[model samples]
Target: MANLCVAGGTGQVGRDVVRLALDAGHTVSVLSRHAPQAGSEKHHDGATYFAGDVTTGAGLEAAVAGADVVIDCLEGQFGKARKRFADGGVRLLEAADRAGVRKAVVLSIINCDRSTAAYYASKSAKERVYQESPLETVAVRATQFHSLPVAVFQAGAGVGLIPVFKGARFQPISPLDAAAAVLEAALEPGSSEDHRIRTVGGPEVLGMREMAVMWKSVTGARGRVVELPLPGAMGRYLRAGLNLAPGHAWGRETFVSWLEKRRETL
Candidate 1:
């Protein structure tokens, strides 16, 4: 079994990746700022947790040492998100190289190249790092997670209103599906020098209005569904479906099914 390390394994998608990796029977290690203690998710899932910080290059060497594969699920946001991703990614790659890791798997957002949003721009830049570096890396760019729109709707409902972006389209896949894709990329057999990029998305593409309605129905959230035209270039890009991958609709879960399952846990 390969020794796999998951960076940022405590985050949303990272947690799924860690769980799936453990379930797949791989020896797993997770890097996080706070070391995981006994009875924690990592410990219970049979993963070794290492305290590391990618941005400052602290403890990363130990975290990735002797790892056969490294899956990067690191995330950054806001004005400094771009610099954090670019710099931290380079640092992580450098550490991986020192450890002689065989493969580097990176998770990114789909259609990041087509958007000017700060977060998307950072992710697009990070993808380039894998391409430019000599590390054998494969990037799986996935559509927004199904929880994204749900969160938006829930936040709006907190104030008794749902803001639907006019003309916006979303094809959100389950994080589990995205995690599977990342693991597949890491386990693919090939020369370690090969660099590949794949795109994955949900089975169906729906307008923001449609998704809002679905959220309302599934959660029984009563609120005003206010359709508003989003302003700025970011909004224009979203309205144009620049964040979707229609051709790579490999995700099988529908929003309705995801919502139903989600509500059952609430």
Candidate 2:
């Protein structure tokens, strides 16, 4: 088993990565800005947690020390994403290199470079940071997670209307699948000088309206699906299906299946 370090391991996808890594018998260490609270949903018993800020390099050395690989799942907020990702990626890579880490894996968005949106731009920048580093890097560019649309619909549910982009479609993958891909990449034997990119997507691509309707039916949420014109570059990006990777549909979980599983939990 590899000594794996998961940056931002307390977040949604990161939490799954931590769990899966631990399940695989890897020595897992989680790094985040704040230490995870014991007994919290994000905290796992087998993994270690380090409170470190990637943006400023604070506590990074300790977090990454003695690890063989670092899976970067760091996330930044809106408007501040560009600086946070760009600067934080550099610091994280430097710390990993100094710790003699053999490989690094980053979780990124599919077709991030095609759009000029602030979030995509930040993701693209972070990818560059990893690719340029001396350590072998694997960039896993995945489509939207199943949680994304669920959050969108939940947010709009309060107002009695769920907005669906008129021409948008999604191939949303489950976080478990994405985390599995990351683990595979981390374990794959490769040259130390190599930098690779992989894309993964959900089993099926469904229209925005179709997904919203399915969500409503499964969750019993009361809301009318309202089709709205998604204007601007982002709209064009989504309409063109730049956010999808049908050829790399590696995930087995469908949106409905994920929803059904979630409903059981609730």
Q: List candidate 1 segments past 4 Å from native.
A: 41-44, 79-82, 191-193, 264-266
Residue pairs in clash, model 2: none
lDDT of 2 by residue, 1-266 (tens): 78999998998789999999898899999999998789999999999999998878999999999999999988885766556887899999999999999999999999998988878888998999898999999999999998877887888889999989889999999999998988888889876457999999989999989999999899888988999988887888899999889899999999999999999542
Candidate 1 structure, TM-score to reference: 0.94
User: Which parts of model 2 have CA positions greater than 4 angstroms off?
Assistant: 264-266
Task: List, residue by residue over 26-68, the lDDT tens digit for candidate 1.
Answer: 8888988777678766443588889988889999998998899
Error of 1 at 137 (Å): 0.9
RMSD from true fold, candidate 1: 1.8
| Best model per TM-score | 2
| Predicted structure with the largest lDDT when compared to the true one | 2
* Cα-based TM-score, every candidate: 0.94, 0.95
